[model samples]
Target: MTSAPALEQPVSTAESAEPELPTPVVAPESLSVKFNDVGRAFGGRTVLRNVTMTVNPGEVVAILGASGCGKSTLLRAVGGLDVGFTGELLIGDRAVSRYDERTAVGFQEPRLLPWRSIRRNIELGLPRDLEKSAGKARVDELLDLVGLSDRAHLRPREISGGMAQRASLARALARQPGVLLLDEPFGALDALTRLKMQDLLMDVHASTGTTVLLVTHDVNEAMQLADRILLLGCPDSDPAEGATVKSLVTVPGTRPRNRASQDLARLGSQLYAGLGVDSH
Candidate 1:
């Protein structure tokens, strides 16, 4: 894993302050998320079963698992993007509604409109009720935060892949989401760009303090970004019961954790093991 610079220092108050989005010059509130015996099935086949876990306010939780283990399904359940699940899923004490306003989702694809300017695409996600002037300021703040201010006026096709993803992230932030759900947002990026995106995500998380639920296949990425790692899998390598929580690990240390730390390396090996990959 490539280590990002400035991973050993805490973000200062001024640097970490939330942007003028969400509320005019006010920071958005981070919300808690809960899954109570959540289970999802497509007809007769169960993909996720008994997924019960809580993501605390302002904390980042990363989900990892085998292929077809329902990682994306779990994330979509929280986003209210998929309604086929059983049991209760809540965000900030309210049962999740279809396309809940309290959350925003970022998929593996940037999904930006080809015709719209990057700024325009991001503006599309602003709350409908926000005043015109406030919305502009919010979008401006987001642009600066995501380092897309220079490319704000450019179309999605003009910028690099990383820049497009940043625009996507900014759009998601424009919703002022209390809970941000990401399904492998960086999985499509190349190795170096992905590392850079990981660092950028940490910076954004530090600044916004929004509760984040990230579904990723990379153990190192999880260790780098998540406060806790939530591993889902079918027990004993059997696929009959569906995937459920197999390990919930609390990563040690503070934000901007050292990527080269022995603690993290050891923990990474353990996580890979839990996923049925042996460290040679």
Candidate 2:
């Protein structure tokens, strides 16, 4: 099987060079994810239970919860990485088992190959069927989009962490997947870098109109990035019973939202309370 891109680098790059190509346009309704009564268990120990949610096409949804509340498990289920869950998980009209090319996942790490240049790493995510020349152009376009055009020839070890993560995002987009699954993709960055990445993500989302499913622990991150937030809470305070969707909070207003506004602060407070956190 072809290896998935590493977490430390972005996606893989093209093997040969070609002229630059225009960015591809993705159909707006190509990808929509839905979960129905989904549940998972290990050795009869439930991890997630009766969790149901829907991510509309072109929408950005954030999954927020305390650690070990199965946020990652839920994401994995959507990405087709974890198939042990029960009930239904669908990407568009087909089951996730159908493995549609319109979906891609990004992890916390860039996962770039050390030997490959930045450009090459991003190229790895391109469809294998793309023409060599077209692949090169696509890579160039992504590098520019991620603000790494000048650094394309550099190896992974040569760039900063923020740059690497940006490359990782580009790699995921390289496949031009309509649904982008991100699991704490900016969790490890410095505060400033993390905030910058968030803005960059918003820009990318606006341009591509890709549906996003983000799993994050940062309340502000969710408020800043997601149009809707899913709070998974532990019912009866029992792990064995598993965590389920506690609340779905919708953020009001337009893109480029003001994180410092009272509206977001109020929403953040609610999210924190749901997670059993005291912002006081």
Candidate 3:
């Protein structure tokens, strides 16, 4: 175990102390995600229903809502982490199955194994039958993508919180999943780290082109990261039916968008209102 480098520091191959390694051979790509009339219940109470939307390939879609309104429930359904729901979830045209390989999840916590080196933990994500050389190449690529290439040998307890989160993200990407599901991946970080994580995610998406489904309660985060924001809330007139898509808003700018743009503020205000929050 060793101390981690600053999370904000950029690690480039040109400045590394070690010999340059061959570029990883793993190519990045994405697929579409669709949920058709999906619904879920627990203890005889419905929490999500009638969730219908199609996420185009390589799009970043954010799910925003009040607590317990089923934002995460809907995301889990897509990743096949929770399957006791009604209707269908389609990942790249195939209905989702238990432990679907087409998708990978980056949970709120890093969930890294304490005993394994960061490199080995990422290796855990490779397909069981992937060729030995290919798996190594994929793990190498992921470590670099998440800025953990230099820290590859350290145990989980050795790194800063941000670094651990990066490792977790690399592990998720190691699968080369077409649809990446993120459940508040930055929710646990400090404000500055959260912002950095957001930027890192943006870069990852740009480089990998993986379609992303992110669930978060932060309105501003939704505004900053998503191509479109999906707001979920139970109809005020029909609370008994559980939460559903309340509105789908197309964000007004491009990737690495203007964080201070007034246009984003207007959309944020509207999303706040949708969640029954006072923007003022």
RMSD of each: 7.3, 9.1, 8.4
Model 2 reaches what TM-score against the true structure? 0.89
Score residue 183 of candidate 3 by CA lDDT: 94
User: Candidate 1 has what TM-score?
Assistant: 0.90
* Over 4 Å off, model 1: 1-26
List TM-score per model, in order.
0.90, 0.89, 0.89
Residue-by-residue lDDT tens digits, candidate 3, 1-280 = 4866643334477667544443333344578988899999998899998889999998999999999899999988888898899998898888999988989999999999999999999998898889999888888878877888999999999999999999999988888889999999899999999999999888888767789999999988988899999999998888878999999999998988888999998998999999999999
lDDT of each: 0.90, 0.86, 0.88
Model 3: how far is 190 from its true place, Å? 0.5
How far does residue 134 in candidate 3 sit from its true spot (Å)? 2.1
**Candidate of highest TM-score:** 1
Q: Report the poorest 10 consecutive residues by lDDT, candidate 2.
A: 18-27
Worst 10 residues of 1 by lDDT: 17-26
lDDT of 1 at 118: 100
For candidate 2, write residues 120-174 as lDDT tens digits.
8998889899999988887887888789999999999999999999999989888
